[model samples]
Target: MKEWFERERAVHIQFYRRQPVVFVKGEGCYLYDVEGKKYLDMVAGIAAATLGHCHPKFIARVSEQLKKLVHVSNLYYTTPQIELAEKLREITGMDRFFFCNSGAEAVEASLKIARKATGRKKFVAFSGSFHGRTMGALSVTWKEKFRRPFEPLVQPVEFAEFNSVEDLEKKVDEETAAVILEPVQGEAGVYPATKEFINELFRLRDEYNFLVIFDEVQTGFGRTGRWFAKEHYGVKPDIMAMAKAMGSGFPIGGVGVSEEVAEKLEAGEHASTFGGNPLACVASLATIEIIEEEKLVENSEKTGKYLRKRLEELDGIKEVRGMGLMIGAKVENAPGMVSRSLEKGLLVNATSENALRFVPPLIAGREEIDFAVDILSSLK
Candidate 1:
């Protein structure tokens, strides 16, 4: 394992500050390092593994598809891709969708569709929001550090204070083509938008004729106890970008657009070569089926509340925020807590300087939640 790490460090780009442990295998909500030490996975691949690691059903589905057909390109139609698209439409109530390979690509597609559909130039986003890292997604994402080096990004984007209706009103105008936001901000410490704030966006949309694009990359696929996070507010978006858990651990993403917006996007307007491959499509289908059949969404809501309640009882926790399995607890020393938790055989994320983010798989139950709490309780 040390040799492998050294070789990777020598050749690969240093994009991530990886942990010292080298994970060799995972099952359910647990991962095993190369030394055969087990660790509870609270991060869930940063909330991408909705069905947990190495799920038998997921593996079987992917294996079956690989034996038959894997990649036929978008030039021809395939059953798995169409079936997945239909499933997304059934779940999200959106008329159309475009497949991609990651959350960033989904956001990029939503941005382009918004411009083409509305014929406008400017876009409105909120503070403490993380859409993605690509140029278009980065333009709308908050955080000066990520944007500073990648200057001259996609232009005509404005940022407003998150959850501030007054700030949002002031920033959005007639020239704004779209207003993109996360129903629950993931990387920004799991801040869920207030109902008033989301409602205000719709109010402004009606008046200004701008589109509302919900960036649900982290909050969709039962992460928030709903099919999508926007459902919590009882409002639908003109466009929605989703990925994270859509393919379990497999990489896949998509943008859902309303009929009005879909009509404007013609062929050749956008495409992805490996976006809707058969393997990814089957993986997503299997993941969604498992989430539904196992009643994992309801479990996420119930177990999440229990976990949050437990965290709130901790002495050093300042606040607990978010819904379902996507939770963030503000503590005095988030980085220290994360490091200690890892040392104690638990995997979690220190999102911001003061917040510890928990995004366990939807399959997590009270036992898993209790184990995670035990680790945190020891810190106090």
Candidate 2:
């Protein structure tokens, strides 16, 4: 294994600083390394696997689709693409959609729609919100580490304090094309926006007429145990950027826009070559069906409550905060705790140096949650 890593390092461009073990295969909630050791997958590819790894239905659909047809240009439409779009529209109630290959592309499309519809140059983005990595998306993303190197690049984006109505009001002006935010901030430690904050955005939208955009890449697709996190708050956004789990690990993403906003973009205004390809669209359709048919959203809610209840009872936990499956716990030495949990064959992400973010598979069961808690208890 070391020899294989050395060989790959010698030839390949170094991207991620990966762990020592090479994952060989996965089943449901568990992954096996090359050495045959199994680990419980809490991260779920950053919450992309809506139904868990190698879900029978998911695999069967993708496998069958692959045998039929894979790709054709966007100039021609495919059955899967049309069906997927209709399904998404039915679920989100968004008037129209623009398909894309990934989250960043979806975000880029949202930015274009916002700018074109409002005829405004500047955009108001919240601090600690992660849109994506592309230039347009990165401009709105407000993280120095991700933005510093690409300075003087994408333009006309301003940052505001998340959940601070005063800061939002101060930052947003007539020149602001859109106000983009995550209904629940994911990468910044799973902090949800306050009811007051959401109401403030709606107020701003009504007063300013600036488009409202929800970066629902993480908070969508039942990750928060809700179809979209915004539904919990009862606020509707003009545009919603969706991806991550949209295709259940297949590279697919889309932007949902209101009827008013959707009409602004003409045919030639935007396009993607592989946007609504057959394979990805089929994957997405399969993913959504599995989520609904299996009632995974309800499972997420039940398991989330059970897990949160157990976690909140832990002695060393400072606080447990989140909705449904998107949970974060503040504790002393969170990074160390994560490391210890990894040693015990469980995986989770550290949101802060001291906050543990748990986005386990929506289908994760009672046994899995109990096992996770067992590992967490040992950390204390």
Candidate 3:
């Protein structure tokens, strides 16, 4: 494992602060390092691996699709793509779908669609929000570290205080094309938008004619125990960008648009080569089916409440925020906690300097939750 790490450092880009533990295999809610040390997975690949690693159903479905078809041009039609769209419409209430490869690409498509649909230039976003790393997504994302190196991005993007109606009202107007936000801000420590905030945004949208785009990349696909975060607010967005758990870590994402926005799009305005391919679509379809068949969403809700309750009782925690399995606990030293937790055979990450984030797989049960809480409790 040490030799493999050395070889990787020699060739691979050092963008991410790579962890020392080199995991070689994962199953259910656990991962095994190259040295055969087993660790309980709590991050779930940054909330992307929905079904956990090597889910039997997900693997079988993808393998079946691979045997039949794999890649083709977007110019041609595919059954899996259309079928996935139908399933999403039933869940999300969106009329149209555009496939992509990641959350960043989905946000890019949403930005383009909003700009073209509304014929406006400026956009409105909130503080502590994280859309993605792409240029357009980054423009709306509020973070000095991520934006400092890449200044002069998409122009005229205004940042409002998260869940502040007054600031949102002041920023949104006739010139605004769209307002992009995460219903639950995951990257900046799981800060969820208030009901009043979402209501006011919709009211302003009607008056100003600007679209609303929900960046549900982390909060979607039952991560928040609701299928999508918008359900908690009971408000529908004009455009919704999603990825992460969509394909259970199969590198697939998509943008869901209202019929009005769909009609505004012209041919050749946007496309992707590997987006919505047969294999990716089948993977997503199988994921959705398994989640429903297994009742994982309900499990997430039940287990998440138990986890939050346990965290609230911990002396080290200051506050607990977020819904379902996507949770963040305020700690005095998040980095220290993560490091200590890792040494004790647990996998968690620090979303911010003092906020520890947890987005375990939907399949995680009470036993795993109990074990995880014991590790965290012991650390405290």
Candidate 4:
């Protein structure tokens, strides 16, 4: 360890440690520590690098934009931001959009839109949902461990059972402003909502006239084998929040809203200082273009199926669930197994205390999956 790390051991910032190595560079599907030792990258910056790290296209676009305007306040329009927003509209069928600096900011904007559109204070969120850590986003997040220390969060946020239609029916009412959920819950060990549950969300929204917001931050940009996981169930939400893979590594987040809900917010109702800077927008555009040109979504679906099937047959795996490149394998003693995998040079996360999670890049193929399994099989 370096002297800086040793001295900062008692720092106030919370850190998530998975292995002893610190990454300094990344390529298609690998990371190199500062010492130049290489390891296969399976996390993809917690699912942020949909196109892998330091992609040639990304570098090219960002490099070209660095020579031009980088940022302009929301007061003025910029070409890159407008162009990117148009592409998003074409892809998602959302009429309007708002950009923000991070996933938390996008979630906060969604909440504000929901409240303003419905004129109701109470909002419904599902258990095991990880929206973001900001004050407003944290309000609706149901993880007790994350919310415990910050008591008295923004008021009137309600938690409903995940994937339980009956529970949602009982909790949602006329006073509810919106119902927020992750179509495929990522942080909750890759639990996917059933087709029935997805339909129920739309039904309840129609019955109660509340906005439905899908937090696609983890599953969007081809992570879940689709452009958006909501498409899997043929249901469309009033608003959608996405971020993790939107810029492929750059800090950017966005919210898409229906015309009905979007019209309520007049001029000066919302904005961000550094949300849609030229650099971030250009990077996002390049990522989307690469995904389309290379047909990475199809690869995610095919490769992910093979990987999931192989993982299900692995020793000590209790259950494997999820779609596309985003997968979770339940195992006994997940935390210990995760540490053991790290020691063996295969990286994975214990998303739940008893579940091993994998969110490899969309380009990960059978050879990589086989290597991952080989390493897991070696774990005692």
Candidate 5:
């Protein structure tokens, strides 16, 4: 397997730091490697598979869609695409949405829409926010390491302190086209935005006429115990970029836009070739239905609380933060601890130098939570 991986690396780009395991199959909250060793999945493909691997409904729907149709460009309308868009509209209460192939593309679309609609060039983004790696999204992302190498990026981005209403007020001016933030900062250790801060953003948006964009790429689709993370604060964003669990394993993303913002986007302004194809659209629709019918949003709230409570009781932990199944715990030697957990048949992620992230599937139960906690407590 190592030889095979090395061979593949020769041909593919070295973009990802992959694990040593070669997974061959997945079902529910578990994955099986090539050797047939079963492991509990806590990361849920980095929170992309909300319903867990190969969900029966997800598979059936995608397989059926495959037989019927797959790729028909935006020039033509497909039923699955329209249905999925309507479902998104109902969930977000937004007038329209533009589909894409990944979270980065969604973020890119939101940035373009904000600039086009408001006719402003500057954007205000919070520190520790991870929008995406694309040029437009990367400009707003706060990490110096990711941004330094990609110099001469989209310019005139101002950084504000996360959860600091005062700093936000100071930075956002009339020239600001948009303010982009993750309601729950996933890569920055699952930090959720304070209600007070969110309220202030809405106030600023109304006062300055700049759009407020929520980068829900990682927190959407019941990851935060709600339909959308912004819902927790009772605030609506002018544009919302979402992907991750929306398609349950398929590469699909979308930007929900209010009627006002949608009106500014003229035809031939922004487009994706393979975006919103039938396969991805059907998979997304099925994933949404399964999340609703199974009541996974409520489950995320209940299970996540239980998991956080248990983690808090453990020794050698500094902080436990986040909502629903999206959780992060600060611990020593985070990366080493993650590797140890993998050895014990558990899959988790280290989002930072000291933060261990747990974003299991929405269908996770008490047993899985207990098993994961036991592994963490036993880690040295």
Candidate 6:
């Protein structure tokens, strides 16, 4: 372990302060460290692993794809890519799809589409919002710590107080090319946008010609008890960016656009060399199928209600917020609690200074929640 740590420090950039434990393998909701200690993974790789670790169907599908073809690039048409697009269309209700490698790339594509289609530069984002780390996405992100170092990002982007209809009213105008936000803010303590706020934003979009973009990277793909978090508001966005759980553990992301915006996009305007590659598309297709076949979205809804009820009963928690399995509990010291939980064989993480986030796999049920809540209760 010490040798591994030293090697990491010497070879890798200090991008993240990772947990002390070094996991070797995972199965279902459990992870095993080098010392063979078992841990219940309640965070699901920060909501990226939709079907948990090494799900049989997920493995089988990907293995089959690997035996045949992998990356042929966007220059050629691939069946898996088109199949994944059709699945997304059924679930996302968008007219066009643009595949990408990661959530940040998906956000970049969405930002480009918004600007090109609307022919405007200014954008409106909300406080506590985390879009992505890419330049255009970073410009819309609200955290100063994430944005300040990358000084002079894509300009003219403004921030409105989250869920504040009055502030949003003041921020948006005809000059705004787009208004981008996560329906549920994951990094900023799992705060969800209110229906009133969404309704008002769409009303403003109708008045001004700016596009509305939803960054559903963390909250999409059954994490929020729905196919996408935008469905909670019952309003369709002009553009939507998704990733995280899209291909479970595999790296796959995409941007979906409304017909109006799709018409404005030209082939040469934007392209990716490995965007819609075969292996990634099959992985995503299998992920979607697993979510559908197992009814994990329903499980997320039912089990989440139970989990929230259990969390609310805990003594030390101030409040619990979020929909479905995507949740955050307000606590006294999030990082301290996370460490303590890890010591007790439960894997959880802190989203912010005082908030502990839980985004377990969509397949998680009442049994798993009970075990997690028991650990939490004991800690409290």
TM agreement with the true structure for every prediction: 0.99, 0.97, 0.99, 0.97, 0.98, 0.99
Q: Which stretches of candidate 1 lie over 4 Å from their true place?
A: none
lDDT per residue for candidate 2 within 130-235, as digits (tens), equals 8888999999887898899988756788899998999998998777889999889888888999999999889988988899999999888888878889889887
lDDT by residue (1-380, candidate 6, tens digit) is 67788888999999989988888999999899988999999988889988999999999999999999999888789999999899899999988999999999999999999999999999999999998898988999998999999989998999999999999999999799999999999999989999999999999999998999999999999988988888899999999999989999799889999999999989888888888799999999999999999999988888888989999999999999999999999999999899989989999989877999999988888888889888988885
TM-score of 2: 0.97
lDDT of 1 at 91: 92
lDDT of 6 at 87: 86
The residue pairs found clashing in candidate 6 are: none
lDDT of 6 at 180: 95
lDDT of 1: 0.93
- Could you tell me the lDDT of residue 80 within candidate 3? 98
Deviating ranges (above 4 Å) for candidate 6 = none
lDDT of 5 at 11: 97
- lDDT at residue 290 of model 5 (Cα atoms): 97
Off by over 4 Å in 3: none
Please give the lDDT score at residue 234 for candidate 6.
Answer: 97
Query: What are the RMSDs of all candidates, in order?
Result: 0.9, 1.3, 0.9, 1.4, 0.9, 0.9
lDDT for residue 347 in candidate 6, whole number 0-100: 90
- In model 3, what are the clashing residue pairs, if there are any? none
Candidate 4 residue-pair clash tally: 0
Q: Write candidate 4's Cα lDDT for 161-253 as tens digits.
A: 998888988999999999888899988899999999888888888998999999999999999889989889998799999898999988999
lDDT of 3 by residue, 224-343 (tens): 889999999999999999999999989999999999999999999999999999999999999999999999888889989988998899888999999999999999999999999999
**Weakest ten-residue segment in model 5 by summed lDDT:** 1-10
Give the whole-model CA lDDT for all candidates, comma-separated: 0.93, 0.88, 0.93, 0.87, 0.93, 0.92
In candidate 1 the C-alpha lDDT for residue 111 amounts to 95
